[model samples]
Target: MRLVTYRRSIEAEARLGVLVDDLVIDVATLGERAGSPLPSRMLDFIKLGPVAVSELGFLLKEAGGRWPVNGALPLAGVILLAPIPRPDKNVFGIGLNYIDHVAESAAALDTAPDLPKQPVIFSKPPTSVIAPGEPIVHRADITQQLDWEVELAAIIGTTAQRVTRENALSHVFGYTVLIDMSARDCRRAGQWIYSKGQDSYCPMGPCIVTADEIPDPQTLDLWLTVNGVEKQRNNTSHMLFKVDELIADISQGITLEPGDIIATGTPEGVGAGRNPQEWVWPGDVIEAEATGIGKLRHPVVAG
Candidate 1:
């Protein structure tokens, strides 16, 4: 199931829905019809755990995939917001999780090409998130080096702390596409918060695909394109620290809750690693995609 948070109009409240073919099936309305009302907020819905998905499935099957008039909308007619528009906490990020990305970054920064013994975790504040087709603010006055990193983000379904690698996948609810927008020149002594936590820096979600559909998160392909040109292209199989390890490793000290997102990191083809170092400027378009999850297209606009 492809879950989404959307609004029928600019003034309308965001609604929870499931994407089916070209339609958005309103989960709240569907649940109400089935006498098992669901939450309208993504976070609340996610907190319902695996049983919520199973219940939704039963409701869908009962309807024979045909939703009532008020319970469905054409996909194009609604504004697709970030699934979990305002994450309960900062979105966790893994840096240099891809071996090739680490090598390229080291070469660009003139450092040793060393692999991290564990996940290098960072974060983007909740305020940084924007929806699909939203504008990525290019604050030229703040920093001129705007960069993009396409990532596959895992959404946690349950509270997890000190879990083992073998049981980490059980805590995941689903996956979504996330773009880690960075301001390269704004790095302050190697800390990424100022460089990556600016407003509108994280563009996430076309929709979240439930975990059951993608049993093996490592096998998916993810890629990014600037305007019409492909810049980053790779498979999740290339990640040095896979999804399960990341969850287990991070959970050792910090607790991960439902609605928490972990951006599993990007591949080698980022702007900073390019020979001439390309930067995203006003009027540029960035489209990022992960298999099973959909595409996120955002335009760069002057801030």
Candidate 2:
């Protein structure tokens, strides 16, 4: 099942939803009706692990493949929010993990083209995350060079510490599309938090496709576009450090808990790597997608 967090209006509380075709099934109410209540928040729901997932499957089967009119809302009628709207901690990110992206950065930023022996990890504050259809804030006073990176985000379902690479994927709950927005000029002394961690810098969601549906995340296709023009396109197969390696490496000492997200590095063709070097300015729209996860579209707006 494709899971989501959504609200019917600005004043409504965000609720957990399961996508069934073009409809959003209210998971909480559905469970309540089945005499097995479920959490309304995505994070809380994720913490329940496979049992909750199994229950959802049972509920769907019990429904006989049909939902009452009031039980499921039209996908267009709800405001889709970030699956985990506010992570307990910062969002983990991998940098320069795509071979071609590293090469492009070398040419554009005057850096060496050598691939790193280990994964380069970074963090983005929770505030940077925004939902689909939200505006990506462009602070003119702070940055004139805004860039975009289309990445596949992995959400952890179980606690992981010192996990082996072979067993790493079992800890993942699902996958979603995440656009890493950057202020190219804000980097200082090689640190990226200032450039990539500002509010609304992350545009995530459409919905989280459970890991069960995407057995091999590496084979998926992903791409990004600006104002109807394609800019980045590549398969997850091109990633220099795959998802399993990332999860295993990250959990060596630090713990990865439920609802934690890891954004596997983006592929080549970012605005910063273009021949003429483009930037996303106010009024432009960015649309990015990963095969089964779906697309995220956000307008660029002045801060």
Candidate 3:
């Protein structure tokens, strides 16, 4: 069952939704009829543990047939929001997780070591997140160069601390696609905070696909395109530190809670790594896609 966060209007309350076919089921409305009202917010519902997820699975099965369809709407009827619109903490990201990407970045920096000793982790403030189809505001005033990164984002289903690699997969709730928009000029100065923390720097989600559906996260295909031209394309199998290892490594000291997003880094085709160097300009429409998880599109606009 695919889970979502959405609303009918900007001022309308954000509610939990489940996508079945082309329909978005209002879990809260359905729950009310069953006398077991589910939480309106996706994060709150996720905090309820696996039982809630299990119940959602059952709901998805019975939805169109016996369940009330009053609150259900076609996918185009409502506004889709980020799976976790308001993340509890900064979103975690891994840099140079792909071997080819590491080589490219190293070459650009005139450095050595095709691969890093450990995963390079950084944080993107929650406010950087924007919904799919939303505009990724280009920070043109302060940044002369803007870049795009298409990455697969992992969502934590439960609290995890010092988790072993063997048990890390079980802690994952689902997966979503995140476009990690970057300001290359600001990033070259060192700290990735200001470079990546700009408003709408992260365009995330069409919806979250449950982890049960993905037996092996590393085998999926991911791609990104700007305007009508393809830019980045690769499989997750190339990741130096796969999903399980990334989770275990990150949880070694920090506790990962439900709804926490982890972008597993991008592959080698970023614009910044090109021979002549390329950056996105205002009015560019970018689309990022991952097999099974679906696609995310964002339009670039001057800040």
Which candidate tops lDDT? 1
Better of 1 and 2 by lDDT: 1
Tens-digit lDDT string for candidate 2 (257-303): 99999999999998889889999999999999999899999999999
- Sort by TM-score, best first: 1, 2, 3
Task: Write candidate 3's Cα lDDT for 204-254 as tens digits.
Answer: 998999888997899999999999799999999999999999999999999
Candidate lDDT (C-alpha), each: 0.94, 0.93, 0.87
List, residue by residue over 201-239, the lDDT tens digit for candidate 1: 999998999999999999999999999899999999999
**lDDT winner, 2 or 3:** 2
The CA lDDT at 101 in model 1 is 94
Off by over 4 Å in 2: none
Worst 10 residues of 2 by lDDT: 63-72
Would you estimate the TM-scores of all the predictions? Answer: 0.98, 0.98, 0.96
So what's the TM-score on candidate 3?
0.96
Candidates 2 and 3, the one with greater TM-score: 2
Instruction: Tell me how far the alpha carbon of residue 270 in candidate 3 is from the true structure, in angstroms, after superposition.
Output: 0.2
